[model samples]
Every structure is written in C-alpha cells, then in structure tokens.
Target: MKVANKNIVVTGGGNGVGRELTLKLLSKGAKVIAIDVNQFALQETFRISGKNPNLLIRVLDITDKESVFNFAEEIVSSLGHIDGVINNAGIIQPFIDLKDLKFEQIDRIMNVNFFGTLYMTKAFLNHLLTRPEAHIVNVASMGGFFPFPGQNSYGASKAAVKLMTEGLYSELLGTNVHVSIVFPGGIATDIMKNSDITDKAASDSEKNSKLLLSPAAAASKIISGMEKNKYRLFVGKDSKIMNFMYGINAGFATRLIKRVMGSKMSMEA
Candidate 1:
C-alpha cells in the first residue's frame, strides 16, 4: 500500500502531526487532501506545504456525518479515486478528575475523538473498497493503552478509537483495505493549544523534559508504516516501551503512569 501516486485524506491537517503528515505524504508523491476545522490553520498548513499542486486543503468538521459523506463523494468525484484516509483529528478533555468533568465536556471529547473518526471512515469506506488497494490509519494515544488520572475521558475516547481500528482491521481481513492503528506517546506538538487546555503545571513539567519526539520524526515513522501496510504502529520510544510494560502487567503500568503524571495533574484540580 505505497502512498505514492495515491489519493489520501488526512484529518486535523492544520497543525501538529496532522500537518507533518500532509507535508510528508505530499513529498512522497501522493495527492493529499488535508482536512481541518480551522480555515486559518489549514491555510497555514497550505503555506508551509510550498503550495504543492498535489495538495488540497479543505475546512471540514469530521463529526458531522452528513458533511463527511458529502465531502467524501466530492473527493471521489473530483480526484477520480480514494486510496487512503488518516483519521487524525482529535481533542483532549480538561486536565481534571472525571468527577469534576461535566457531561457536555465528555461528550465533546468523545464526539471529536471517536465519533469523528467513525464518521470519516464510514463515509469513505465504500469508496475505498472500490479501489485496488486502500488504507486507513487511525491515531490513538499512549493514554489509550495506559490510564492517565486527569485525562480519563480523553483516554477513554482514544481507547474506543484503538478498539474500533482493531475491529476494522479484523473485519477487513482478505479485503483490499489495509487498516493501521497508531499509538503515539509524548510528541513535541502544540496539541494542548489545539485542544484549548491551559495546564500551566503540565506545561512546566514538559518544559523541563526533552523526551518527546518531534512531529517530523513521528510523521516519518507513520508514513513508513503505512507504506509497508503495517497493522500496528508505535510512534515514540515511550510508546514502544510502555506497550511492553502494559502487556506484561496492567496494574503495574497503571500505577507507574499515576506516579509519574499524578502530581502535575493534581495542580489542575
């Protein structure tokens, strides 16, 4: 499932790893359609892409199923085919306890992180099935695998994404679609700013650390995995290590994450 010369769609392409994915896919000779909720941010991504002819930027809210279907129809009609889709758009819940989180806040996180990915995948799945070979890449998180005290809702939503992607991979077996689930650990990106979270405590902690992977490196690994049609892709060293740890002992992994992130998270509460 080489992305070169394929028609690929990337959601949340305005910033962070999504923006990097757009740039990397374009560089690999793919015709990329970058989707984002922010028009200004999409424009910024376009500007950073050197305005490549192969790149198309679209302002889209992936949570709207009707709109996603219509947009997928338009892409297939205009581009002549749909080869791949990267469900990368997502938002984080506030860094507070689950008891302190309102129902509406939980809804917002689930809608964007899980339902949004579901809608996009459903809308384009039929179109993808028509292709000789197609690909689906869904980005989950380390939090999806290991529990984070303050980011419970966010982690749950991503966990849903992880399971959904895995189910898709299983169901699509013997089909032309190559489904991949990505579990990304700490990465050097403005995800907090994008998610509208103001966690000064967590910000201070991050500033003192140099363990996060860069967006470019993460994107490179993702694209390479997609090209190889990999089933599971781990973006950072932290993701790979924690994956093994969690697999060995879930209780220990949960306690370790709590010990590491709980203090900073308590400041938000």
Candidate 2:
C-alpha cells in the first residue's frame, strides 16, 4: 500500500524507532498521529517535523483500554480514516535471569509490551475493518524468535506479540488490512535503558553492545515492510540468526540463545 496521502498512527512515537518511522512516513506524504507518554519527546518530535500541519501528537498510555480506544476514536474523527496502524509502543524490563527474575518485572513487561499492543489493536479493529485497504504493523523483536538469558520478560513479551500478530493475520486474511510483523536486532537505540539496568556494571555492558544500524535505518526497513505488506520483517544479522534457529525448534533455540547471549556481551567488549 502506498503511504502518500494515507493517515497513519504510530504508537511510542515520542522517541527511538517510533519517532524515526513517523518522520519517514511524513516524508512519504502521509498524515501521522504520534502517541507517546513522554510529552517532552513528543514536543521534540513535533519540532523536528518543522511544524507540519499533517502531524498530531497525544500523550497516551496504551495499557488503559479506554484511553487507547478513545484516542483512536479521536483520530478517526479528525482524520476521516486510518490507513495504517503501527503497534510500536513497548517497554523492556530489567535484565534478570529466570532464576532471579522478579515477578513484578515480568508483569510490567506483559502489561506494556503485550497487553498494550493488544489493546491498541483491538481498539482500532472496527475502524480498520471498515477501511478498503489498511495496514497493521507490529514491531516484535529478534528476542521473540530466539530466547536469551537475562531476557525473560522482554523475550516473552515480544513472543506474545508475534503470536498475536500472526493470529490477526489469519483472522483478517483476504481483508483490506494487511498485517506485518517486524524483528529488529541491535539497532542504535535506548531499549537497554528501558531494561532498567541502572547499575554501573550492567549499564556499561549495555552501552557497549553492538549497534549494527541506526534507528532511522531500522525505521526505513520497517516502513518498507509495511509498504510491501510483508508477513515478517527482519532487521540486522541477529534477526537472520534467530530466523534460522526458529526453523529448528523453539526448545533447542532457547539453549542456543543462552549460549549466544553469553558470548554476545564479551564479544562486544
């Protein structure tokens, strides 16, 4: 589907990948509604977009179904119809091994990363169903395809997203809305920060993690995936590795991921 003249909604558009994609969508002549909890980042994004008249930013918390549903209603009211919806808003919990993982952290991850996306998609489903041709893009992760130690909550959350998107695709087959899932690797972004690793040791280790692509680069590929209506989009080498492992078995993949993640940090050093 062409992006030009389309009304697009991007969640988590305050910063990082979401912001980058929104900018690109606008460049493609699409009207965008950016939703994020960080108003400061929203202001920055708006400023960066040069006061474009086709942009709208709202502070939103997706976990609240009512809030998200209401927000979608507002968008449809103002924009006439939504041509694309990107479920990009998500959070990463602290890096904790399954042995020492906190239950609260796990709950938080599921709340935002999985439930949040679900709520947003559900809220907009009726609207999307009405459109002649629409797109639904869910930003999953390489972690979803391949598990890693210290990524219990993060991986699980994205894995849920993967299944949810696939189910949506199956349900909407031959419909106007095309569904796509994205798996991004070590892009230069602040997702590690979202992991809540405030300790100097973990912070330093995360800071040195390999950055294979810029946020803008990943965002470009993601947007391209939407245009082509791809079933899945992989970003960077990590995604390729995960895809190969996924073909084997998720059980064996878990062990392989643990071994790989152990070396990933040291190799980064």
Candidate 3:
C-alpha cells in the first residue's frame, strides 16, 4: 500500500537501511514510528530527520516478546492504528566456522534475526488485520537462500525469516495485510561495526567493491516494493542474480559461493 499518511513502524531505525527507510518514509509524508535498541543512534536518526513531526523514535528491544507486545499496545493507543511494519533489525556473527562458534553466538543471532521478527509480526498482526489496508515487510538476506561459508548461523536465521514471511503471505491471502519478504545483497552499511564483529578481509572487500548498494538506494527499493504490494523484493543486483543462479542450479550456486568466500572464512580446530 502507499505509505503516504500511513502509520508505519521500522525496527533498527537507528542506522543503516533502517535509518534511510525512516528518512525516506518521512519525506513521503508517512507517519513513521522508528524503533531501535540504541538510544543514541535513534537520536541521531531523529536529528538527521530534522525532528520531523511525523517521525516517532522509540527505544525497544524487539527480542523481548513482552516489550514488543507492550510497545505495540502503546503505539496503537497513541496513534490509533498501524498500517505497516518493517522487520529490519538484524546482526551477523563473526567470520568463523559454525563448529568454532559458541552457542551464545548462535542464540543471539537467532533471537534477533528470527525471533525478533516473529515477535514484531505477532505483536502487530491483529492490529494490522483491523486496519483497512496494511503491509508487513520482513528483510531477509542473500545468504538466506544461498550459502556463505562463515555466516552459516546468520544465514540460517534469515532463512527462517524468509520462510516465515512466505508462510504469512499464504495465510494472510485474502486479508488486507500484504506480506513482502526482501532479500538484500551486499549493501554498503556499518553492519559489521554495529554487530560488533571484526573481519578485516570482508571489510576490505566491501570497501573495494563498487557494486554494493547504498543504504538510501536500498531503502528506496524497499518502499517501492511495499507500495506495489510485492510478495518478494530483491534489493540489490547481486541478490537478483544469485536468486536466478540458485533457481537454475542450487549446487552450482553453492559451489560458486564457497569457491569465492571459502578462503576468507576463519576456521578453528
């Protein structure tokens, strides 16, 4: 649905694509409720937005189910209703093999990327059903469908999101709430820094790559897809290409990715 005059909620609105989404939505005359865990980053996003009256920044941990439900209630009470929600907050693990990765790391990734999206969707779903027109956009990753050696856990989490979103679409068919799943590939953002992980090789490669999509550009594509009520949206060219490649031959795509990113991955015995 068109976002103009709609009350939309964007998680991870502190920075990266989320921040850009918040700014662009405001520019489009949408009333945005931007949610993030980082208060400072949310403040910065608001500052960059020039304190738009249509923008509301909230600090909430989406991983906490109770907090998510409470936040939903508060928004409904204040704004009356919500038209859309973008589950965009997620983090990546270190560039290491799953065998070497700790249980804590795996849990953290799943909690934020999968369960967080689940909580947000569940929290606002009933309210969305009440609206005349509503939308739900869940941001998965290129690694969700394809594989990247070191990021197995992260990919798994996103894959869950991908399937969950698709399932929601099937269930919500004939309903006013439109469900869209997004697969984004290699966006130029501070994801590494924000995730508190350090990978010099990955960082250097991203810096040298000209094909990576900017946060602003990715946000534009997401909003456009939402406006069109698209079922699946691929943000970057890389994501689209990989989708095609995987569709043609999953084995070939897997091997190709392993061949390119294998050596860069850090493994431990």
- The clash count of every prediction, one per candidate, is 0, 0, 0
The 0-to-1 C-alpha lDDT of every candidate, in the order given, reads 0.91, 0.85, 0.94
Q: Tens digits of per-residue lDDT for model 1 on 1-269? A: 99899999999999988999999999999999999999999999999999899999999998788998999999899989989999989888777889999999998899999999999999999889989999999999988988877899999999999999999999999999999999998887777778878533246456335798878888999999999999999888899999999999999998988887877656745
- Each candidate structure's TM-score, on Cα atoms with residue i matched to residue i, is 0.95, 0.90, 0.95
Off by over 4 Å in 3: 199-208, 263-269
Ranking of all predicted structures according to lDDT, beginning with the best and ending with the worst: 3, 1, 2
For 1-269, candidate 2 gives per-residue lDDT tens digits of 78899999999898888999999999999999999988998988999999788889999988888998889898899778898899998777665687787788788889889999999899888898898889989999888877767787788999999999999999999888899999988776676554456533234444455746777988999988899889988988878877887787877877777777789766955
Give the per-residue lDDT of model 3 (tens digit) for 33-94.
99999999999999999988899999999999999999999999999999999999999998
In candidate 1 the C-alpha lDDT for residue 58 amounts to 94
lDDT of 2: 0.85
Better of 2 and 3 by lDDT: 3
Which of 1 and 2 is ahead in lDDT? 1
